[model samples]
Target: MVTHINLKRCIGCQFCVQVCPRGCFEYDFEINKVKLVNPILCLKCRACELNCEGDAIRIEKPIFQNFFAQLI
Candidate 1:
């Protein structure tokens, strides 16, 4: 599973935090943004990325990408 945060596009709307069933996201009041507090806890359901209007989240890269990524 892949989970990333793009602060440039993220509006800190908390959509990811609210939609994540695994409690993988958290809000950082200091930065006025959301953070991936527990990526391993993600179920790779893509709910966070799909619900993100800002398109800042990406989960589960393609199978080929995952295979090669492990080699590196």
Candidate 2:
């Protein structure tokens, strides 16, 4: 799973880049944008999503188990 940054929404504030513990983001100077650098190391803590003012970032996570089956 990885986080996706919507370039259109991102304001290039670099808040997400700075808050990530795994160093998953990098700033592209030429385009004035943010890029996902290392995705595998992402802890999925949702820090970036919460911090993003423009709602540019989304953390995608797969369902670990079926809820109905587990309940049964």
Candidate 3:
């Protein structure tokens, strides 16, 4: 799941908005920044975090999920 987005570091580039497969992010023209609109829909794929040039996105997986992922 996505846990945080530091607006101060976000460059309004919309990379996360474009890369999110679940449409969890949106570009807010009023603020010229990206917003996490549907965090519940996040798939924890890290696509948003990896694509964010500003490194403003953070995703946290459950401990069990991390352990299972390591096994795979």
Clashes of each: 1, 0, 0
- Runs of candidate 2 exceeding 4 Å displacement: 62-72
Cα lDDT of all candidates, in order?
A: 0.83, 0.83, 0.81
Q: Which ten residues in a row are the worst by lDDT in model 1?
A: 63-72
lDDT of 1 by residue, 1-72 (tens): 578888888988899989989999999999988988887677788988899988888775655555554344
What are the candidates' C-alpha RMSDs? 4.0, 6.0, 4.9
Worst lDDT 10-window in candidate 3:
63-72
User: Clashes in model 2: which pairs?
Assistant: none
Error of 2 at 13 (Å): 0.5
Off by over 4 Å in 1: 62-72
Residue-by-residue lDDT tens digits, candidate 3, 24-48: 8889999899988887777778878
TM-score for each prediction?
Answer: 0.79, 0.79, 0.78
The TM-score between candidate 1 and the true structure equals 0.79
